[model samples]
Target chain A: MNFVEKKILEEGRVEGEDILKVDSFLNHQIDVEFLNEIGKRFKELFKDQKVDKILTVEASGIAIACICAQYFNVPVVFAKKMDSKNLDKETYESEVYSFTKAKHYTIKISKRYLGRGENVLFIDDFLANGRAALGIKNIVDQAGANLVGIGIVIEKGFQEGRAILDDLGINLHSLAIIEKMEKGKISFKSL
Target chain B: MNFVEKKILEEGRVEGEDILKVDSFLNHQIDVEFLNEIGKRFKELFKDQKVDKILTVEASGIAIACICAQYFNVPVVFAKKMDSKNLDKETYESEVYSFTKAKHYTIKISKRYLGRGENVLFIDDFLANGRAALGIKNIVDQAGANLVGIGIVIEKGFQEGRAILDDLGINLHSLAIIEKMEKGKISFKSL
Candidate 1:
C-alpha cells in the first residue's frame, strides 16, 4: 500500500477534482510487476477466505483481476460490457451506471460460470460511486454464489462506494484509498 | 501447447460453424494456471525476439497478455474499445469491424504509452477475420513501433486473419489453428 500510494502521488495525474489518471502504470499500460505486488497484498489480506473465482467487469478491471487471480490461484470471470455474439443467451446480467460516461451499460456473465455455493472474490481497478460494485454483487447474488470478498486497487474514500458495500455486509479491501482530492492535491487514508 | 490443445478439446464449445467458445479458460472465465503455461510457451516461442512491450486489445486479450508479459518482463498496453472520460484525447485510433457482432468500433490507445522505436509483441485470444489484428497493427504503425511478433492462442485457419497478418510480413505464431469446423466437429492444422 505504501508503494501504491507513493506511485499514485509520483505518477498519478489529477484531472479536475475527481479523476485520477494512472493509465501510465495501472490501467492502459499495465505495470505487471507492480500489479503482482498488489495481487500478493490482496492474497495476504484474504488468506483465510476460500476464493473459488475472481469476478470483475471488463476493460480496466480485467488486468487487476487477472493479476490478482494468480495470487488467489483461481479462475477470473469478468462481466462483459460489450455484447458478444458468442456470449451465452442464459446469463446473469446487472446494470451499472457510469457517472463519467453518463450512461448505463449492462454487465453480463454466463450462468454456467458461477455455481451455487461457490466463493467469488470481486476485484476491480477503482471503486467510486459503487455502481460497478453493486452490479457485480447483483450477479453474484443471482448465481447463489457466496461473495467471499471484494479487493480494490484504488478507492475514492470520499465517495459512497465504501458505505454502500459495507451496508451490504461485503468484506471489502482496498490497497489505496484517496481521502481527499481537490485543487490538484490528493490525500490518502492513513492506516 | 499440448495443455492448451487439450483445454480447447475439452472445454471449448463450437457454436454454428465459425464460433469456438473457450470462455471457460481463454476469455470469460480464465484458468490462471493453464494460461500460465500459455505465457511460458509464448516466451519460449519468441525467446529470440527482444520484446519491449506486449500489446493487445481490451477485455479477453488483457488476461493472456498480462500473464505473458510476466515471462517477457515487459509491460502490456491494451487498446480501449470504449470511450472513457479518463482516456487521453490524444490517442492513436483504429477502426475494427467485428464480423461476429456485425458492427464497427473504434479502438484507441493513449499516445503516451507507446513510443516511437519500442519493440512490441501483439498477443490475443483468437484470430479469425484479422480485423482486430490489422486494427492493432495500425496503432503500432501509428506509434512508429516495431512489431517484433504476433502470438495467437487459437487461429481459425479457414479464415483470412492469418493471410492478412502474413501479408504484412509479420512473424506469426499460433498455438493452435483450427483447420475446419463443421457440424460441430473441429479439425486442427498439424504443425
Candidate 2:
C-alpha cells in the first residue's frame, strides 16, 4: 500500500458503511506535515502536465490546494460555496448538489482570476458522487479554461464518480482509493 | 509601510464604503508565495507564544491558517461554519452574528482536537466586528484551551473588532491596519 492508503488505515475511521472519516488528519484537524507528503506525491504524479493554476471548492479543499500549489509554484483559486456580497460581480458559477446537505448550492469563481486557455488542475479532499468535481469542471468550461486533470486525496471507488470522470476522459489521480468500507473494517483498491 | 500594506494598495480594491476587497491574492484567488511571507511575519509577531495548535474558522480562514501553520509547525483545527451530519457529535459550538449575512450562526469544533490547557493561536484573514474571533474564542474557552493570541493578515482599524479583542485582554496582531477606506481612497494606520 502507498503512503495515503497506509495513513487511511492508521487514522481513518469507517462510520456505518459509506463514510470513511479522515477528519483527524485530512480535514477537521489538518496535519500539515502529512499533507506536505500528499502534496509531494501529487506533484510526482502530475509532474509532466503543464499546470497554470490549482482549482478547488472552499473549506476542505483549500488546505490541500494551497499546500500542493507550493510544488507547482502556481496560484490557487477556490470556488466560493456561499453567495456572499463580498464576491466579485462578474463571476463564473455552477450549481452543485451536496448529498450531505441534501440541497443544491451555487459555487462561484471571479472571472478575473480565471482567464481563457488557462490550465487548471482540480484538487479536493474526497471524491464520492463527483458532483462537486463536475461543478468545478463546469466553471472551468465557463471560463474557457482547460481542465487538465484532477488530483484527489481519497476516492470512493465503490461509487460511480470514477466511472463518470473516466467517461469524460479527464485525467484523475487519487492517492488512496477505498473499494470497501464497513463497520470496523476498510479496504483499498489495489494498484 | 509594510509588505502587506504595499500589497493592499497594489492589489486590494475598495467597493462602496466599507468593503476592501483583497480577492486577487488574499481571499478568492490565493497567492501561495505571498501567504508564505504572511506566515513568516505572523511567526515573527507571535514567536514568543507557546502555541500548541493553530485555530481559525472555516472557508476563508482555512487557507491562511494552513499556510501559517507551516511556520509554527503545528496542526490547524478550523471550526465548521455550517452544521452537518458529517461532523463529530461531541463539539464545542459558539454562536456568531454575521453583519453581512445579517443572521446568527453556530460554529463548531470537535472535542477530539482540542484539550484542556492546550495553547492555541487564532489566525485569520480579516478582523472586522470581532464576531468571528469572539466565536472562536468561545470555542477555545469551552475546550479549556489557552488562547495565546490572535494573528490577522489585515485589521479594519476603524471597526470595533480591535477594541473588543483588546477588552478581552487577548494579544492581537494585525499586519496591515486599514484606518480609512473611502471610494477611490485608502489609508493605513502608521505603525
Candidate 3:
C-alpha cells in the first residue's frame, strides 16, 4: 500500500477534483511487477478466506483480477460490460450505474462459470461510486455464491463507495485510499 | 501447447460454423494456471525474440497479455476499444472491422506508453479475420515501434487471419490452431 500510495503521488495525475488518471501504469498500460505486488497484498489481506473464483468487471479490472488470481491460485471470472456475441446466452446479469461514464450498463457473467455455493472475491482497479462492485456482488448473489471479500487497487475514500459497501456488510479492502483530491493534489488516508 | 489443446477440446464450445467459444477457461473465466502454461508456451515460442512490451487489445486480451508478460518480464499495454473520458486525447488510433459484430470500431493506445523503437509482441485470445491484430500492428507502426511477433491463444485456420498476417510478413504463433469445426467437433492442426 505504501508503494501504491507513493506511485499515486509520484505518477497519478489529478484532473479536476474528482478524477485520478493512472493510465500510465495501472489501467491502460500495466506494470506487471506492481501488479504482482498488489496480488501479494490482496492475498495477505484475504489469506483466511477460501476464494474459488475472482470476479471483476471488464475492461480495466481484467488485468488486476487476473494477476491477483495467480496469487490466490483461483480462476478469474470477469463480468462483461457490453453484450458480446461471443458471450453465452445463459448468464447472470446485473445493471450498474457508472458515474464516470454517466450511464447505466449491464455486467454479465456466464451462469456456468459461477456455481451455487462458490466463494468469490471481487477485484477492480478503481472503486469510485462502488457501482461496479455492487453490480458484481449482485451477480454473485444471484448465482447463490458467497461474496468472500472485495479487493480494490485504489479507492476514492472521499466518495461514498466505501460507506456504501460497509453499509451492505461486504468485507472490502483497498490498497490505496485517496482521502481527498484538492488543487490537483491527492491525499491518502493514513493507515 | 498440449495442455492448451486439451483444454480447447474439453471446454471449448462450437457455435454455428465459425464461432468457437472458449469463454469457460480462456476469456470470460480465466484459468490462471492454464494462463501460466500459456505464458510459458508463448515465451518458449518467442524465446529468441527481444520483447520489450506485450501489446494486446482491451477486454479479453488484457488477461492473457498480462499473464504472458510475466514470462517475458515486460509490461503490458492494452489498446482501449472505446474513447473513454479517462483516456488521454493523445493516442495512436486504428480502425478495426469486427467480423463477429460486423462493425468497425476505433481502438486507441496512449502515445506515452509506446515509444519509438520499442520491441512489442502482440497477444490476443483469438485470431480470425486478423483485423484486430492488423489494427494493433498499425498503431505500433504509427508509433515507430518494432513488432517482434504476434501470439494468439487460438487461431481459426479456416479463416484468412493467418494468411493476411503472413502476407504482411509478420511472424505469427498460435497455441492451438483449429483446422476445422464441424457439427461441434473441433480438430487441431498437428504440431
Candidate 4:
C-alpha cells in the first residue's frame, strides 16, 4: 500500500453504509505535513502536464488545492459555493448537485481570475459521484480554459464517479480508492 | 510599508465605502508563493507563542490557515460554516452574523480534533467587524483550548474588530491594516 492508503487504514473511520469519515486528517482537521506528502505524490503523478493554475470548489477543496499549487508553482482559484457581496459581478458559474448536502447549488469562478487557454488542474478531497468534477469542468469550459487533469485525495471506486469521468476522457489520479465498505470494514481496490 | 501593504495598494480595489477586494492575489485567486511569504511573516510575528493547532473559519480562511500551518509545523482545524452530514454530532459551535451575506450562521468544530488545553492560533484573510474571530474564540473557549493569538492578513482599521478583540485582551497581529479607504484609495495604519 502507498502512503495515503496506509494513512487511510490507520486513521479512517467508517460512519454508515456509504459514509467514510476521514475528517481527522483530510478535511476537517488538516495535517499539513501529510498534505505536503500528498502534494508531492500528485506532482510526481502529473509531472508531464502543464498546470497554469489549480482550480477547486470551496471549503474542503481549498486546503489541498493551495498545498498542491506549491508543487506546480501556480496560482489557485476556487469556486465559491454561495453568492457573496465581495464576488465580482462577472463570473463563470456551473450547477452542482451535492449528495452529501442533498441539494443543488451554483459554483462560481470570477472572470478576472481564469484566463482563456490557461491549463487548470482540478483538485478536491473526495470523488464520490463526480458531479462536482463535472461542475468544475463546465466552468473551465465556460472560461475557455483547458482542464488538464483532476487530482483526488480519495475515490469511492464502488460508485459511478470514476466511470463518468473515464467516459469523458478526464485524466484522473486518486491517491486511494476504496472498493468496498461493509459492516464498518473498508477495502481498497488493488490496482 | 510591508509586502502585504504594497500588494494591497497595487491590486486591491475599493468597492463603495467599505469593501476592499484583493481577489487578484489573496482570496479568489491565491498566489501560493505570496502565501508562503505571508506564512513566513506570520511565523516571525508569532514566534514566541506555542501553537499546537491553527484554527480558522472555513472557505477563505482554509487556504491561509493551511499555508500558515506549514510554517508552524502544526495541524489546521477549520470551523465549518454549514452543517454537513459527515460532521459529528458532538461539536463546539458558535453563532456568527455575516455582514456581507447579511445572515446568521453556525460554525462548528468536531470535539475529536480539539483537545483540552491545546494552544491554538487563529488565522484569517481579513478581519472586519471581528464577528468571525469572536465566534472562533467562543468555540476555542468551549473546548477549553487556549487561544494564544490571532494572525490577520489584512485588518480594516476603520472597523470595530480590533477594538472588540482588544477589549477581550486578545493578542492580535495584522500584516496590513487599512486605516482609510475612499475614492479608490487605501491608506494603511502607521503602526
Candidate 5:
C-alpha cells in the first residue's frame, strides 16, 4: 500500500454501511500537508503528460484539483453543478446524479476556460459510481479537449465505477483503492 | 493595484448589473499560477500573525484558502454551506444572507478542525456584502478561535461590507477594492 492508502486506512471512517467519510482530513477539514503530498504523487504519475488545466466538480473536488494543478503548473477549472445566469449563456454541461444528495444536477463549465486540444486532468475526493467522473468527461468531450488523466484521491474498487471509466479509454490514476469496508474494517488494494 | 487586482480588471466581466463575473480566472476557473501569487501576497500581508489555519466558505473559497495555507504551512478548513447528513452534528455554524441570490443559508465548519485559541485566517474571492466573511467570523467566534485577518481578493467598496466588518473591529485586508462599476468601466481603491 502507498502512503495515501495507509493514511486512508488509518484516518478514514466507514459510516453506517457504504459511506467512507474522510471528512476529518480529506474533505471537511483539509490537511494541506497531505494534499501537497497527493499533489506531488500526481505529478509523479502524470509527469509525461502535458496537463494545461485541471477540471473538477464544485465543493469537494476544488481543493484537490487546485493543489494538483500547482504541481502541473496549470490552471484548475471546477464544474459548477448548479444553473447560473452568468454561466447559462456559453457553457459545456453534463447531468450528474448524486446518491448522497438524492438529486440530479447539470454541472456547467464556461467555454472561456476550456478549449480545443487542451490537455485536461480531472481531480476529485472520491470515486464511487463514476457518475460525476463521466459527467465531467462529457463536458471535456463537448469542449473538444483531451482527457489526459483522472487523478482521484480515493476509489471504491468494489463498485462498477472503474469498469465504466476504463471502458471509456481514459487513463485512471487513483492514490488509494478501497477493496472493501466491512464491520469498520477497511481493506485496500495492494499496490 | 496588485497582480490579482490587475488580472481581475483585465478579464473580469461586469455581468448584468452588479455581479462581477471573474469566473474566467477566480472562482469557477482558477488560475493556479495567479493563485500562487495570491498565496505569496497573503503571506506577506499576514506575516506578523501566526496563522494556524485558513478558513473560507466552500465551492469558491476552497482553492484560495488551500493555496494560501501552503504559505502559512497550515491547513484549510472550508465551511459547507449545504446541509449534509454527515455534517449535521458537532459543527460550528453561522447564517449568511446573499444579496445576489436573495437567499439565506448556514455555513458549517467541523469542530474537529477548529479549536479554542487557534489563529484563523479567512480567505475568499469576493467581499461584496461581507455576509460570507461575517458568517465565517461567526464560526471562528463560536470555536473560540482568534480571527487573525480576513484576506479578500476583491472587495466591492461601494457596498456596506467593509463598514459593517469594520464595526466588528476585524482586521480586513483586500488586494483590490472596486470603487464602482459603471458602463463596464472599472475603478479600484487607491492603495
Candidate 6:
C-alpha cells in the first residue's frame, strides 16, 4: 500500500475538487509491477477469507482483478458493461449508475459462471460513490453467493463509498485511499 | 498452446456456425491458471523480441494483456473504448469495428503512456477480421512506437484476420487457431 500511495502522489493528476486521475500507473496505463504489489497486499489482507472467485467490472477493473486472481488461485468473472452478442443469453444482470458518465448501465455475468454458495471477492480500480461495487455485490447476492470481501486499488476516502459499504457490513480494503485532492494536490489517508 | 486448444475443445461452445464461446476460460469467466499458461505461451512465442510495453483494447483484451505482461515484465496500456471526462485530452485514437457488437467504436490511449521508439506487444482475446488489431496497430504507429508482435488467444483461421496481419508483415501468434467450425465440431490447425 505504501508503494501504491507513493505512486499516486508522484503520478496522480488532480483535476478540480472531485476528480483524481492515476492513468499513468493505475487505470488506463497499468504498471504490472505495482499491480503485483497490490495483488500481494490484497492477498495479505484477505488471507483468512475463503475466496472462490474474483469479480470486477469491465475496462479498468479487469487488469487489477486478473492480477489479484493469481494470488487467490481462483478464476475471475468480469461483469460486462454492455450486452455483447458474444455473451451468453442466460446471465445475472445488475444496473449500476456511473457518476462520471452520469448514466445508468447494466453489468452482467453469465449465470453458468457463478454458482450458488461460492465465496466471491470483488475488486475495482476506483471507489467513488460505491455504485459499481454495490451492483456487483447485488448480483452475487442474487446468485446466493457469499461476498467474501472487496479489494480496491484506489478509494476516494472523502466520498461516502466507504461508509455505504461499511453500513452493509462488507469488509473493504483499498491500497491507497485519497483523503483530499485540491488544486492539483493529492493527499492520502494514513493507513 | 496445447492447453488452450484442449480447453477450447472441451469448454468452448459452438453456437450456430460462427460463434465459438470460450467465456468459461478466456473472456467473461477467466481461469487464472489457464491465463498463466497463455502468458507463458505468449512469452515463448515472442521470446526473442524486446517488448517495452503491452498494448491492448479495453474490456476483454485487458485481462489477457495484463496476464501476459507479467511474463514479459512490462507495463500494459489498454485503449479506452469510450471517452470519459477523466481521460487525458491528448491521446492516440482509432476507430474499431466490432463484428460481435455490430457497431463501430473509437478506442483511445493517453499520449503520455506511449512514447517514440517503445517496443510494443499487442495482445487480444480474439482475432476475427483483424479490425481491432489493425486499429491498435494504427495507434502504435501514430505514436512512432515499434510493434514487436501481436499475440492472440484464439484466431478464427477461416476469417481474414491472420491473412491481413500476415500481409502487413506483423509477427502474429495465436494459441488456438480454428480452421473451421461446422455442425458444432471445431477443428484446429495442426501444430
lDDT by residue for model 3 over B1-191, one digit each (tens)? Answer: 48888999889889999899888888898888999999999999999999999999988999999999999999999999965999998999999999899999999999999999999999999999899999999999999999999999999999999999999899999988999999999998876
True contacts recovered per prediction: 0.99, 0.92, 0.96, 0.97, 0.85, 0.97
Identify the leading candidate in terms of lDDT: 4
Q: lDDT tens string, model 4, A89-159?
A: 99999899999889999999999999899999999999999999999999999989999999999999988
lDDT of 6 by residue, B68-185 (tens): 9999999999999976788888999999888878899999998999999999999999999999999989999999999989999899999999889999999999988999999999
Which residue segments of model 5 deviate by more than 4 Å? none
Better of 5 and 6 by DockQ: 6
Please report the TM-score between candidate 2 and the true structure: 0.98
Error of 1 at B54 (Å): 0.6
Model 1: per-residue Cα lDDT over B112-155, one tens digit each = 99989999999999999999989988999999999999999999
Instruction: Name every residue pair that clashes in candidate 1.
Output: none
* Candidate with best DockQ: 3
Every candidate's lDDT:
0.92, 0.92, 0.92, 0.93, 0.87, 0.91
Predicted complex 3: DockQ: 0.93
- List ranges where model 1 is wrong by over 4 Å: none
Candidate 6 residue A131 C-alpha distance from true site, Å = 0.6
Candidate 2 regions with alpha-carbon error over 4 angstroms: none
User: In candidate 5, which residue pairs clash?
Assistant: none
Candidate 2 local lDDT, A42-157, one digit each (tens): 89989989999999998899999999999999999999987678998899999999886789999999999999999999999999999999999999999999999999999999
Residue pairs in candidate 6 whose N, alpha carbon or C atoms collide under 3 angstroms: none
Native-vs-model 5 lDDT?
A: 0.87
Stretches off by above 4 angstroms in model 6 are: none
DockQ of each: 0.91, 0.87, 0.93, 0.91, 0.78, 0.90
**Model 2 CA lDDT for position B190:** 82
Superior by lDDT: candidate 3 or candidate 5: 3
Q: Please, what are the lDDT tens digits per residue for candidate 1 over residues A43-62? A: 99999999899999998998
Q: Is candidate 3 or candidate 5 better by DockQ?
A: 3
Q: lDDT at A180 for candidate 1?
A: 93
RMSD per model, one decimal: 1.1, 0.9, 1.1, 0.9, 1.4, 1.2
